[model samples]
Target: MSPMILIALILQICVTNVITGEYSEVVHNFKSIRKNVALSILVIDGDESNIDSSSLSSAEFVKVPNIEDLYIINILNSLDKNIFTSLHRLQHLKIEENELSYIGPAVWAGLDLEKLSLRNNQIEKLDNRAFDGLKASMIDLSNNKLRTLPNKCLQSLRLYKLTLANNQLEDIDLETFGPELAYADLSNNLLTSLDVEVFSGVYALLNLNLSGNKLTSIVAAPTLKKLKVLNYSHNQISVIAGNAFDSYNQLMELYLDHNQIFRLNHQSFPSIAPIKKFTIDHNYLTGLSDELLNALDNLAYLKFGGNPWSCKCLERVLEFIRSNKIGTDYCESKLIPQGHSCVNYYDKCYGNETKILSQNFEIYKNFIKHYEC
Candidate 1:
């Protein structure tokens, strides 16, 4: 049978119900249905009123014997401690856009959940044992009022993806998450710096985004050996340690643009054998060393525009781009069709002088050799 026919057959055989109202009214409506019929899915979108927990205490009133997914949204009052304790077979639970600010530890004790999303709420604190017995693989707590992650808040869980973006986070304890994390986003917060030991146990981490924050530096711990993509853009970074990326052997793309960086040391990068794209545009950089140019021998895409480039220093970079045939459309000039020129031209170099890199290679090479760093 085709997939559509198979889905239709399944829908014909299964029973699904959607309940929306105040919690007491939904329970009354659910009780109106015939007993002993297993429910496949239950979605309860609460009205903007406090939940009446007393109405949901009995199994006959609110029991969903075989529910696979449950979504409850816009609940106004705090959750009872045993609200989800009876949902032993629940696989996915989403309770979003509510006024919930805290979750007790034992609320989700027996759930066999796989994904839990509490997004767009007023959550400010979570107990350490809040997620103790869940089989959750992904947790999203974005757009909340969270200022700090409690210690061991995510301990002993099997989460592979965690999103804590757009919160008021100022600092995070490293021991909050486990080693099974693969993707984490902590952007758009108030973090000033991250401790190097924060990622010591996350060996499986691949993508880490810390953009749109107040960070002043890019320091990577030695444990991020498998990191592939790192985004540290839109920060206040002015200095990058030379060995900041020495441990990232599998890094593929690095974004350090939109900062205040003026220079990069020769030892700023590790082996670039696997790097495919590198961007440092929109900064205060005036020049790049020959050693740094040599390190980017394998990069495919490079962005060096939006800077106040010195004419003499720009000549060396142009020579490297010409000799290696680095394919890029950024540095190209509109006036001269031959080669690229500085955006803000200095008196020492003219717009037509940039063409010397390709037209007169030896003379340009000699000229760059005599120029000092």
Candidate 2:
């Protein structure tokens, strides 16, 4: 009962309508509300240039044209064909910071819109029937100025969550996506390359944000039998091709943090044995080969703080990160775990009654030690 007091009691019984001037004052502020007292969010302060489907066909002087969430603060460039055929119980449509270039194909044919945000728009292009009769679950064209992605303007949608993050998208036509995609935010954008024909369509992709983007290498990909999160982090990646995740078995999180990964290949995560959250922080690693640390086993988290660790084999990778406490404080919030002059030096146990340096040993006099008897 305390999520900020249930969001302040659902914002005190949801009711918002910020309609601004001109454009016939949005049907004179929907004829001063009162058609069965309704309004659960319908902010419309637009008219910076256009938006006139004959002024929403004066939605019967909408006191409650049954608006189902529709925000349009400053709609600019275009969109006026059937502009929501009299808002038939419209279903969530936000026209963010507009500079919207165009959107024709009968401007949303027969609306059943579930959600559609033209996020920050400056929309560069989108033609082939721009979205013929949009059916949505989610479509936030993040930031926008899309460079490419026009294979029949998102071939007949029935979207499933597609936010083309920040944008200047370099390429994308994963078979005109739509096999009930589960989530596909193409982060940052300007993708340098990637087209292992991503699972030859039939996508049910489970979260695939190609983070930052300008990717250098990570090719091989093929069988994404329902992928489960693969955010190829800020990139310029230096190779990670071992069939770059043809991994099925619902692959769990795999982020390759800031990249240039100098090396990591022992059949790179052979079928990621149910991997759990594996990041490769900063990158350009100087050491890591215990067969890629026993092919990363059951990791709950292994962020590998920044990289460059080579004091001639930094204690066998700090003895597998201190015998598995593996939490190098992800980029510091508290990290004191790094050693070199043959750090901690451990190796000795000859039965009968053994006890050596379990208590005191701090030798550093022109030091040089190694004992195996």
Candidate 3:
């Protein structure tokens, strides 16, 4: 235990501490890198330092900077071709705010990619073979300039929801969607006429939005028995065929608002074993027929507001409304010429406050005497 022995022991202890510290630091750094799937080209604003394509992982999602002008061709070439070489395991891919035109053929070839979003792009056309190798279930192609979809373009996917709202499609042929299509959004378009055969075999469809279009009339399908919701708002529909809804027994909500309709026939809706709801607002209705009242056996909800309804001698439907429990509030025009009352020759010419129809009293006897004499 001299000075020389103590100095040698001190030197050994310092050297051992340095070695242990270096080993611990190296192990911690290695573990951190392994935990994360190494990313590539995380361009915050196209900064050159953030472009590192060599250390990318195959299973990682890499977000690019806001380079909307870069076309899809350059974006595809920037990635390592080997990264997307095996196209079967890709699950999610989003390319937001790009100037991508039509998706060419074989772009997604041999891929089982699901849940794709191509929002805020300038795509004008959707090539039919663009979705050749995808078996996706959910696809969002909203906010594009697509004019039409080719027949049978989407007849392969087992999709659960397909949204193509806010586009420029003027017409739609329902045959483009496969039979497995369950939900859809075709609203905010310029569609004038929809092919009835497009929904011929789509028995499993649950919800549909054809609102905000130019539909003049609907040729109802007798085979859409499983349809639950149908929206045809903001159109030019004037006449609804008598047997248009003969087969939609399971429909729960039907919207036909903000249109140019004049009459709602008694046989407009089908007689389902279960009840249904109907909306017929904002139209040019003249009167409600008596046959239409008898047809409403199980109508739970009905809205006929915001229309130009006429009040004439044939306004017996108002009396019918007071007799039964209407589905919705049946409002009468207080400013009509007859003041919510109908005057006929068989009844007395009473000016307002006449709630009862004089069918068996002096009014009937006077009408018979005038006609018989």
Candidate 4:
């Protein structure tokens, strides 16, 4: 499953067990909640040896040992050090599609997990005391083949949700991410850039996915003003500097959509950001600056469809995104130009003519000679 690790995301325990023969003594129920242990050991199809204690030939876990959510799917390939030291109330573990490559530190010696799932797997390496004493607060080492990381490896966990999306990460050391990392999924991976001071030790972020990867630009970050969901869609972004997001104003979902943007000004952003849901959509944008359309007047949601606009100086922000349906209903028969009017460049069709921006593609009309009214 390698095409840069597609996700696995396990956890769907629907217990039943209780067959009582041919290697039984498991006993889970799940509805009336008897749960005497048998928290999913689905060996994808059994036999090949690797999981110890004889694949847990259930001595009934030494008699009903109140286990807590454990699911060891698609079996065998490594991991035997301690192998769940008799589930001391295992606080949720997942161990995905396996062929575990290595993960010793006596495999979480005295577990303290609050959710850990070594997704997919073939772990390329990890044992900087592989989680010294567990203390996990959600860890999913996405897929795997992990390349590097050891700044006190997870600075003694206090994590609050970190996925390390698809692994083989190119660079990360968010100062050993802590301060209650509030959800981060370094999407895909092999990030090409990101030193916004590695977010000054995660200032309580709320979701930040650097989608796909190989980012090209989007810097400014006043330690991310408590981001509320930010995804730099796909990547290869074409510069988006100036306060790129320093004031985010508690952003509520913002994606820059596929990149290579063709221009955007008015100090780039923050006319008092109150973004509710926004997308820059396919890129090469050609207009928008009535103070970024009045800072998108609290859009409940909007996606700036493709782009190449300049539709008569963006007729009042495309009539306020086609009268608030948000995302222009097919831009008047597909991207304007069927008799539209807003006279001269800045005589005002929503002031300063939203910045006369129609360099009709030819890669920016050869040398940018616009005005196709």
User: Compared with the true structure, what per-residue lDDT tens digits does model 1 show for residues 1-373?
Assistant: 9999999887755433233221212322324433433665565555644554222333542556566676666644466555676666678888788778887786676676778888898999888777766678889999999999878778578678899999999998978668999889999999999988788788888889898899999876788888898989889887788888888878888888877776777686786536667777666666898888887777776666555556677777767766766654443422123354444433233344433323433423443444354
Candidates 3 and 4 compared: the better one by lDDT is 4
Q: Which structure among the candidates has the greatest lDDT?
A: 1
**Candidate 2 at residue 46, lDDT?**
49
Which pairs clash inside model 2? none
lDDT of 4: 0.64
TM-score for predicted model 1 compared with the true structure: 0.76
Instruction: Report the lDDT tens digits of candidate 2 across residue range 1-373.
Output: 8789989777655422234221112322323434532544566554543443223334432555666777766645666665576666678888788678656666776777888899887888776776776677888989888888767466468588889898887877666676677788888989888777743664587888888989897655555667777888998887677766656456777888787675677676764556678888666555567776777766667765555444455456656666776654533313335542332222111111112221112221112133110
Tens digit of lDDT per residue, candidate 4, span 1-373? 7543433222112122224322223222211123344432311223344433223333334343556665655554676566566667768778687678778775676778788888887788887777876777899889888867766677668889988788877887657687778888989888888777777766787888889988888756676678788898888786676668756777878888777676665576676677778777566665666666676677766666555555555575656665665543343324333344533322322232223223324465543355332
* Per-residue lDDT of model 3, residues 1-373, tens digit only: 9999999999998677646542111221111222212222121111223332222233332222111111121122122223333433446656545556576664555555556677666778877776776777778888888888877777777787788888899877767777777888898889888778877777678888888888888857766677788888888887788877777778788888777676677687766524456677666554566667666666666665555344441455444544554455424322223344443321233222222212212333332332210
Candidate 3 clash pair list: 174-198
Quote the positional error of residue 334 for candidate 4 in Å. Answer: 25
**lDDT, candidates in the order shown:** 0.70, 0.64, 0.59, 0.64
User: TM-score of every model?
Assistant: 0.76, 0.31, 0.63, 0.32
Error of 1 at 327 (Å): 6.6
Off by over 4 Å in 1: 1-38, 46-62, 312-341, 344-373
- Candidate 4, position 326, lDDT: 59
Q: Largest TM-score belongs to which candidate?
A: 1
